[model samples]
Target: GAGVSQSPSNKVTEKGKDVELRCDPISGHTALYWYRQRLGQGLEFLIYFQGNSAPDKSGLPSDRFSAERTGESVSTLTIQRTQQEDSAVYLCASSFRGREQYFGPGTRLTVT
Candidate 1:
């Protein structure tokens, strides 16, 4: 079975800039999630999308972060005005339902 994948395994950006992190989930997966993990900390949920359902974004840190999923295929997480506080590893996960999520390699974002 194919696993979830993410692009630009590492990214370096300047403060106040923006970055787009990409994720390609396993084919046929209907649920996708975005999470952020700070240095030495636990993962923090950012958003979730299910087939044809409204996205759950209750965990998004602030207005600068957003995510989109196109029909259960590729998903992207966009962060506007990147800041030092926003620096973290952005992880993506996909699953058939809401459990047993398969995780990607994660995109490490570094803001200077």
Candidate 2:
């Protein structure tokens, strides 16, 4: 499989709207992670997935953000009631041992 891929490379939506971002990690990789990078900040961890389970989600900034994956396949991150502050580049990474990771281009979300 390719390194990593993300869909809807860019997105713009009104406040309170909802959006879903998708990520496809390399084949055979069991570790997936979601992060967010604002205009001028480093990536902030959002969620981590091992296989189909997420044991830690303490990095989630709010309850409005959620993520799920299917047995090491594709993963989706949904943002509900999107806010201007939610506008950022959503980054996805995958790894075999959960150490060295490959990253996707990221989905750019903009809320007006």
Q: Please tell me which predicted candidate would have the highest TM-score against the true structure.
A: 1
Error of 2 at 67 (Å): 0.5
Kindly list the per-residue Cα lDDT of model 2 for residues 1-112, writing each as its tens digit.
4689999899999999999999999999999999999999999999899875644788999999988898888999999999999999999999997779899999999999
Clash count, one per candidate: 0, 0
Q: What's the lDDT for all of these models? A: 0.94, 0.92
- lDDT by residue (2-110, candidate 1, tens digit) is 7999998999999999899999999999999999999999999999999999999999999999888898799999999999999999999999987799999999999
Top-lDDT candidate index: 1
lDDT of 1: 0.94
Q: List the candidates' TM-scores in order.
A: 0.97, 0.95
